[model samples]
Target chain A: MKSEYLSEYDNIVRTMQLYIDGCKQGKSELMRPAFHPNASFFGYAGEQLAIGTQFLFDWIDKNGPAPNIEPRIVSVDILDSIAVVRLEVAEWSGKLAGSGVRMSDLFTLLKTPGGWKIIQKAFHWHAAEQRLAA
Target chain B: MPERNTPQKTLESWKQIAAYLDRSERTVRRWEATEGLPVHRHEHERQDTVFAYRHEIEAWSRLRTASPNPSSVDGADTDNLPAPTPIVNKYLVEHDAITRTMHRYIAGARAGDSDLMRSAFHPSATISGYCLGVEYTGSVEHVFQWIDENGPAPNINPRFARIEIIESIAVVHLEVQHWSGKLAGANARASDVFTLLKRNGEWKITHKLFHWHDQ
Candidate 1:
């Protein structure tokens, strides 16, 4: 693979890594550039929609900064301007400690005049009974 | 005219050879479903395992390949076609998020690994449609519930055989003659579109939808 391909892929992996790191460190500025200023974060938890960046920022701060959490990228597949990334995460919080692995993204990354930013986002995760074939 | 023995060209369709060895149709279908009909996939068409000889397949089938090919597509007894393109992939990933989640969940179903499947879902994922000819918009929990209690494994292997992953948009589509060997079995196919989020430095399935040939 060419260095360009590797970088686009790394941008995804590293960008994702940065976003989560921002949340953990309470540095909201860490994730500002990765999203549109109006970018939204959506989640379905118990029939309710968890919305907005600030909603999550507050939640993360209240949740004591989600300690001992480790997020690792399992694999990255690049196709021109689109890519899919699979990841594994572990949280070591009291009683909530658990390991979850998912292949959860189909990103449309634009190599814009400024730089790369996520233009659109969606969601899906694998079932509980699956493994990454090595 | 005497026939020349062009012993080597490269036969892509092992679908025929599997027949000669007296392998069951199920065996052949399984191979076709998984790795693809044992043909060399080119930018255009699949080539034969060897040169297009008259009696090759029949001779290998313990008969005469020359009598006539029974199932050549389009009634033409030649093996050449145009180059392959991304035609099929467009439809496959058109569902986007819904299809992505479906692939992840189906991967879970095939592997008998729950932890592996959970990533393709939200904690609230559910199967809210008809299954076994009944209409039920249930939770992703229910889908996971069934796979846990029941083994959709070897018992249903003969009919519910394989999965094909197209190289675009994370499409994982399948045909199941009997899903997990249910009493009133179904030949169901489904897909969804999905998106990812960077959660704590990791990617997670954030949205998805589904569609199935429900009974």
Candidate 2:
């Protein structure tokens, strides 16, 4: 890969790391560097679409003085100025502990003038019963 | 033979017409019904023998697919078509975002993660597909809720056969190998077609139409 592409890739991975680490540490401010002001999050808690990062931030505020999170970057794909990162997290602590849900996060990032910033975050959740079979 | 651009070159039967178009007769028939593909009947032969003009089929395909130009089509002027290298490169570059969207979709389905699936589509999108030989049509939210309540298929492997983008609109042909909790032991293969739009520099699925193979 070209050096420019590699640099961009590294920057994106680092940006995503900041967001996940922020959530784990309950430092909402850490998320600011990684996410765009207009970034939106979409996920299904049930039938509802969990929109915006504020709710997640609030949840972190309520439960995460510190969260025990094991986050892994599953894959990253980049083309031109856009990149997407697939992430999986196995958490045994915080509010999510004992919930028995397996989650996957897909973050869409753009190479902005300020640097790579996440523009959108989408996620999936699997119940514990289903996880057992898998 | 007829003059260029004129609807001549009378094809006497469906077989000959299908050969000329390089498609099955069934495909052409579906096109005629759904896409308004041109087909003419002999006035004096009592409409028994179907016929079509070669030029008309070319025009119809161009109009339906919204190609960059008709010249890029087969049998058209090869010299007039733009060079393949740069065009293909541009297409692949543009398709990167779409590929990510699809990957998110598959991951979401397999994991029973509503958030990932929601992220793959616009908020207002709707889906129409078959489940267990039954037709299902509903909002994206409804589909999400169904999956949330019922849980996702145990295994979801989606493979893409083609992704065609014309300007801001795209269509993808995908085959999904799926098996869920409710329906176990039955082979569940689904052919999914997704329509996407590029809005605000992002590609998101706007609509989905699909059918299960066994259904």
Candidate 3:
């Protein structure tokens, strides 16, 4: 009998670490298992549509996962195969070397064939003083 | 003799399964074929189709609570996975339910489901943002008003939003960032906890309180 909980917990951490490594390496293959083959990237990527894994891979190739961006887990809840993660992606405007956005990302992920993948992702970022002025 | 006409509420009777999973017949079939969504097994029937037991369906729904939180860098269940004080479990259950509703609401906004967006929260839902030295508070209706005034949900910034639920009660800490058109304005981000009481057997958000991180 499991007193608290087991399994999946380690798998998720491994997956998040994988994502970070993938982002750092700019290797789309690294991200392959973290997202559904049909996974879509929300938010913006210039004037084009940011849908599908190709866009994410390409974005990683171009931008490099926001330099100096670090993730901190605030809390998480897991029940069965569905889980939600709350975290703060702490970073300063100067770190990114451009328009700065500080704060965290709240996300929901589900266990999948390859491993744990993000099904839905939401973020709360701070606007840079310079960009706000512009 | 059981009430046969009451439709067994049994799992995997095509019609029943589709409704239970909130999926279309075609989608359900496809998922069954590929996603390993546990096929139904009707005793003594079927050589071509598969089915699930009612008990298993209920089992899966109950399993959602133990699902792993995959985004944590450490990827463990609260390390302690405290069983005692998770009195918080009630809060957790409610949080999960409402967040799902919120996700559907945001997604529907892309589909032009105005009714969904409007009805997602209680009519009295409210938002408050604090930053620098200023504090702002407004009704949940005002948030929608600003959304309408701006544009669609996707056009808004992905950052500056967090939704947390604790049992039948939940809270959404968020900021509205409209980048274009008239709604292209930024709303300071703050935490707003909503008390979603089980009213008449249905979870309904009654009162919502907002606060600043510093306070």
lDDT to native, each model = 0.40, 0.61, 0.45
lDDT of 3 by residue, B34-101 (tens): 22344544223112234566565544445344434343333232322213222245555554455544
lDDT of 2 at B195: 62
Residue-by-residue lDDT tens digits, candidate 2, B1-215:
33334345777677766666556666555444333456665534112346887777665554443234222223332212122333335665567667757766665665565765676788767665445556455567866776566555545546777676655556666777644544333346666666666666667886565655653
lDDT of 1 by residue, B1-215 (tens): 12234344343343334433234444443323321222222222222122222343332223111223233332332322222233344433333333334444554564444543676555533333233344333345666665665444322222212222211223222333334434324334443324434333223444332334445
Candidate with best lDDT = 2
User: What lDDT score is found at residue A10 in candidate 1?
Assistant: 70
Preferred candidate (DockQ higher): 1 or 3: 1
Model 2 lDDT per residue over A15-128, tens place: 988888777787777777887665656555543446677866675565564465678887776644445577877663465434434566766565566888776666655543
Error in Å for residue B133 of model 1: 48
Residue-wise C-alpha lDDT for candidate 3, range A17-122, written one tens digit per residue: 6666665555557767775443333322222223344655675665544546666777665534445566565553232224345544444555554566665443
Q: Candidate 1 lDDT, tens digit per residue, A1-134?
A: 55887778777776676656754565556656765443344543223355555664565454444445565665565443333454444542322112333323333233334445543333333322243333
Query: How would the docking of model 1 be graded?
Result: incorrect
**Candidate 1 stretches greater than 4 Å from native:** A92-108, A120-134, B1-215
Show model 3 residue runs off by greater than 4 Å.
A1-6, A44-53, A65-67, A92-103, A125-130, B1-162, B165-215
Using TM-score as the measure, the top candidate is 2
